[model samples]
Target chain A: MTTMRTETSTGAEEVRPKSALEPLISAENVSYHASGRQILQDISLTVARGETVTVVGPNGAGKTTLLRVLLGLISPTSGRVTSKPHLRIGYLPQKIHIDPVLPLSVNRIMTLTGSFTQEQIQAALEETGVSHLNGQSVFNLSGGEFQRMMLARALLRNPELLVLDEPVQGVDYLGEAELYELIANIRKKYSCSVLMISHDLHVVMSSTDRVICIDQHVCCQGKPQYVCNHTEFQRLFGRQFSESLSVYSHDHDHRHDISGNIQEKNQ
Target chain B: MTLLDDFLWRAIFAGLGIAIVAGPLGCFVVWRRMAYLGDTMSHSSLLGIAMGFLLQINLILAVFVVAALVAILLFLLQRQKQLAADAILGTLAHASLALGVLAISLMTWIRVDLMSFLFGDILSVEISDLYLIYGSGLIVLLVMLKIWKPLLAITANEELARAEGIPSVPLQLIFMLLIALIIALAMKIVGVLLVTALLIIPATAARRFSKTPEQMAVIAVLIGVASVFIGLFTSLEFDTPSGPSIVISIVLFFFLSFILPAPKTYVLR
Candidate 1:
């Protein structure tokens, strides 16, 4: 399940910042280069109401860079980004590391907002079915538990736009299935737009409505089903993509696409 | 008490005042893992000290101004098109320290027991320095209390904090300002090299004894206070330098905490 396309380079300079367009996100003529490497190119992109955008590309294709820009963590070399007001944003990072000696636990992490009451923390842990871990040290949490803990944290924020960077990394088969199910349920309950970086094509493909193939450029953008059948998806990524063989977990030179390509090209 | 005793009490008051203010802000430095950063800034304060002597201005204000400028320079260098934040901190630390030492050497009038100032003898504190320490520290601590929540948010994740509408740039400036204040006062008590121990070791020892970050911050103060007492006594008995004596006491506590068999689990809400 993959969507492919050609035309990998495009500049997004013409984007306007009109706040009334019902566009959750608009990136116009954005370009970014990190460590003398071209991570993101001049690209125009937009996400609208009820849109779930999946960014996919080979390893180092600037998927992370685009996400950083969306999160306002990194400034683009050139380009203007505009977003709707107070866009209840929730983000799940690639991984959470607490240094073990930091004295942070599951409950502490879940209560990160600090604006939340104890009852809210209890409710989030209950919803994520991770109440048992409330007392556990974060260092002892398994990969799946850690992921669910992070999700529970995001839920505490009550965000309308959920952004996750590779939520299903290093998880067991049952855990992965449970994760996807949990996401579907969250979307249904909250009716929030979901933007996540994932490499598991077999799992995310059928579920994603919008697919944007980014390979240091805008390769293609359309509905997931259309992308799965597109000739462009076939040329760049020909694999049928088994569920067991995921991205970036292997020891060899692995390439990752959170459905964002990880392609490294010097700008 | 005689007039000399009044002066002694004033110096001690200055010491206590600085400890109170630095206790909380120092915890943040430890939380952000910026202990070495505190040392770097404290070292930069020497440049300000030298400038104060050369320019014939108030030493405290000069130290604050110069160290704060160094902090701003650090922030700008961090945003450099090519340099990383860590690299900028490294270069500023060394360059500023050397310039400070060189500037100090140029002043012949600065012959007043330089070793005590360097190693924290605390015998020369004036009434004005006491007032300065308490007043500035109180204001800084009050500001810190007001912004504590947002500060914690930034410490967790900078980008995430900004996305949630927290102004990280301004917050970073405030953080650096508090750090500069700490450097200005702590430089006298800790010497530039030893100030980081006050920020890091207390927090490090506190981590084993507390559950949440807030609790750790509080415990760090207590731990720091304990080390101060131990150090003060040891220095009096052995006639050793107070700065190094305090650091040694801090290290001793750390070792003791590590060697003692800790509980299997601790519950912190």
Candidate 2:
């Protein structure tokens, strides 16, 4: 069972309160049971306008399930999710298998919603650095290229909220940083709230406004720095993992793994 | 040339009209990997034929009604978590075929050539059959053209289409009804056994050369028309069965596509 309510704006005080504005999206203690297994526990999070939130967790931790619940693609077994009325959400799924028999060009996929003009489609592709691939078959795109194409398609709606399951899943390490940076720029450019799932700790540390470390439920969520230093995060990811991320965060030039010290790839 | 002068011209017109509708609808069947679903619908159409014979109703109307009923049943069954789609389809396909064959056997009032229902008698197509083909074919084509974008969106990615506020359930139901309607119309051109081939093969052949979905649909229609012409000519010259002959023509075109540079591809199912 789920319920959603929209309240009228209360009287304003002399000083404007940030809380007065409704959140762009929020889930309230949502729990989901699927296939007779509990995929998600009581989980709650909120995304305000213009905030970039990243969810990080070990695999099989119901991150995708949580995203689907938040997206209203599936209903939770208990609790509810609320959002601003008539909110437009753009979703970039983890992986979409476009049938090879169906011939779809990059430009064609962007206008799938039928709301974009040719110029708008071209501009969105250009914005994502995939303008050259406008006429290329969607099936012919490489993983990184397809990810960018999906981003371009998602941006066509001019969504107030963008939800990406894994924005840079198959991208190379360098491409990963560049894509995250591109996402940050897109957030600033569109001024839309960005929600994504990621495994790149170093990239997420610098890119997101808030990092929610979830394993079945919210382990901890706050500033990336705070979450990185939290005991729960350390236990889940390990002390060594957070230390390496911290080192990478500070140096910004060298790469390091959880078990090893900094190693300069260029030098 | 008089309108009913030769049966060959009537056969050509009937076959071509069926192709006009089957081509685009077949492309969706191929794109969505619903070939088995097509087979299931066509197979169950035989049950509709049997019931029509028993009740002395219009054969075309009976086939349409039964096919639509099976589609609705499949839709409801798919909602239930117990059975996989293929399992349900397999049961329905064979059960409907057995029941249809049994029902046909039980009727002794009129001698029915079972082979004619299994493999079509395109050579004996009446002028009235042409009217049914063209009239219903036009409606299917227009409705398909209207729903093409949303249908393609749902076929490509149901979640994405739903996210974009596309009415997926209604679109899917409409798509199923279109397939049922086509299957009913196509029974005379290609019997229940060969109807799926008419829908899938030309579409597969068109995929080799197409660069866009609209291009694919158009090319598929051309391939379908060409197959009908070739198959009918082959039937005349070689004394082969017309329904199977058309499917063979389509298969030959699929093989002919080997000359094109092979694209790196994967089958959905």
Candidate 3:
């Protein structure tokens, strides 16, 4: 039942001085119980106006439940969640199964939740590099293409907060890094706050402002480098895993082209 | 004047009204895979009829009340997670149906035609029944149109829709109520046993021609209307049962759909 604050450490704050602002969403001492099992216990976290916070945890760690709570889809068993008034959020679920009986096209999915102009739809699809898939049936999308289509669909709202669960579940290794880079670009372009759940511990996005590791509770919370070096992270995912995380962080000099070929960083 | 006075014309008009509404509503039932839920609600309508006869109230109103209650009970029962969903539906469907039969048997004073109630007597529809069909049908269609986008969003991905601030629970309840209304209205045309078939068959037949959900719905309505027309005329010509004939016509259309080439835009995965 430990409560952890997501206050940015001083050194990390020095790197991105303007990252902190009024919190867009915050949860206090939130705990959720289902079927007599405690799924989440005494969890506390906050996402500021322009910060990207990634929650990394093992399977069955209640990460998705926590996201659902923050999104106001479900109320917590104890404690409360507060958010800014009229906060607009774009969400990409882990997976969306469009039944074969449903005849939904990718173009139609863009307008499923809200009205968007044709130009807006085109822009959102082009931003995610899936404009070619506009008229295609959602049921026929490839894994990577489907993820991109969902990302585009989420962006049509021009949300102030982006909540992505997994985001790259069915994508290949090469596409995973590209998708993360795309997310980083989207965050920069829109300057929207991002709250995401990542299962990729070895390649935790270097652009992440903070990383919170949890297994039914917050194990550690701080900058990605700080959490990667902490004993709690090492204990949860072995020391070997932590070392690989650091290695991945240092070798982030290259970027991938759309064709999956690595290009040297010009930035 | 002759057309308005004839029973055959009245039956055709009543069937058309039900078919038009059933087209769009049935698409949701098929998409959500709630054909069994429709079956359960329609089955409970027989209980509504038995109670109506006992209390001397309007049978349609009684049926709507009972079906709506069954819908709410099913919703609550599903949240419990103890019994499997299909098992609960099965228990409720048959239990209410058998109870309705027993109740009707106990009322030996009233002359109830169990055959017509089970398999429908569409040819004997009165003008008052036509008024009920169109009145409630229009309301259901209007309400469905109002919630069309949000309902489709929820059907595609409920978590995403809820996260994006569509009230999924209330919308689902409203959808269940709409189904109950449709079942209550449809009971007179197709009876308790075949109402779900009227809902599910036309929607399935329309799938081969549609590129979008709205297209599917529109095509389903056309298919349903065509089935009713053909089935009625076939029954008139051969002296067969009208409701079963309609169901058979739709089943034939479903099979006929297989002969057409697949829709050019969709690639089945």
Candidate 4:
């Protein structure tokens, strides 16, 4: 099994360039409640520009709720969220059930936000690798094709923040890896910050800059490798994934190839 | 031979006006699966009629007010979380129907034709009724046109719509009010019992034949207008009930839709 090796730690007291350090969105102790039951506790997070953050948690872990709150779909019960003004957000839901009665083509769905020139629409679809499906009915597209089409739609607005909620819900394992690679490429090309919720922690960690482990609260957060070694995360997900777990400790935790081994350095 | 002088001509014009508005509105009803919501508003028109008599006000206006109030009530009740939406609609529909009947029964001074209100008296449509139908129906259509894009977005996926900055709450309230207005305008033509039949059947038939929301809405209007003409002519020849005759024609069209091949190319606009 491939393992994520920790490399750099950004949170450490070290000199960092000011222009590259500002966060695109920051939540200061946000909490959400529905009726009397608490759905989200005092949680905080920050996403910087041109970085990819993956939220990992069990079912009903308030991941979706956090995304909705960040998107301003629902108000937090208390605390505050500060975002860069005029933040253009591109959101892709887990799965959109477009009514077959509506007769929506893939190209037509792009026009839902407003009018877009044909060339611009073509460019976005091309970027997402679904250029040929521009005229096809959205209902007729396969699961992978649909996700790409949705990504195409989200890319049309030239969003600064791209938010995806469970992008690989029904995708096959191979397709899931390819889609994450595609997303990473999109982030690099657009220089946009990405916030995504995913259950496939194993594959996504390679592309992710930061991983937040949450269950009704922000249980642990840091670089992907650091969060993977968190006690709370192990307690929550360790039962089903005992063998494949790879623990790597480093001074400055950052990106690393999964195939790299940590045992040689320790020896 | 003058259009205003003949009651049959007046009935035809009134039914046509209702169809123009009801068809597009009904497409939304079918798309959102709110046929029962439409039914609830239509059924409550009876209580509106009873209120009209008690207040000595215009019947259509009273019906409009009552249906609008019921729409608001449904909105409020929906927030309670105590009862499911279908249950609330069912309870409201039956309760209002019973109360209207009771109110009519208690008032001995007014000689109300209960069957006409229930089944509608298309033959009895006055020239004044035609004015109300066209004027109000025009407003409903215009409002629908203005809100078409956002309403379609909401119907397609409400969470996505909200995330995209559409004001879903106001749009929903406006949609409910539009349904209420259509019910009030259509009550005299199709009656309280079959108003939803008028909205639903034509829209459903059009769905099988249309390639776009706009196409479906336009075709729904065509189907609705055709049903009205067919039902009216059939009533004149067969002497059957006019409202039920229109509903039967629409039902026939809906069934005929199955035989026609579904449209292949979905036009974007």
Q: For each candidate, what's the DockQ?
A: 0.29, 0.39, 0.65, 0.32
Off by over 4 Å in 4: A1-18, A239-267, B264-269
Ranking by DockQ: 3, 2, 4, 1
DockQ agreement of candidate 3 with the native complex: 0.65
* Model 3 alpha-carbon miss at residue A114, Å: 0.5
Q: List the residue pairs that clash in candidate 2.
A: none
The segments of candidate 1 whose C-alpha lies over 4 angstroms from its true place after superposition are: A1-22, A34-37, A239-267, B1-11, B84-86, B267-269
TM-score (C-alpha) between model 1 and the true structure: 0.85
- Report the poorest 10 consecutive residues by lDDT, candidate 3 chain B: B260-269
What ranges in model 2 sit over 4 Å off? A1-21, A246-267, B260-269
TM-score, A chain, model 3: 0.84
**TM-score of every model versus the real structure:** 0.85, 0.90, 0.91, 0.91
Query: What lDDT does the true structure give each of the candidates?
Result: 0.73, 0.84, 0.86, 0.84
Count: clashes, candidate 4: 6
What lDDT would candidate 4 get against the real structure?
A: 0.84
Ranking by lDDT: 3, 2, 4, 1
Candidate 4: tens digits of C-alpha lDDT, residues A177-242: 889889989998998989999998786567788999899899899887777766566666762362
Chain A TM-scores in order: 0.80, 0.85, 0.84, 0.84
**Residue A88 miss distance in model 3 (angstroms):** 1.5
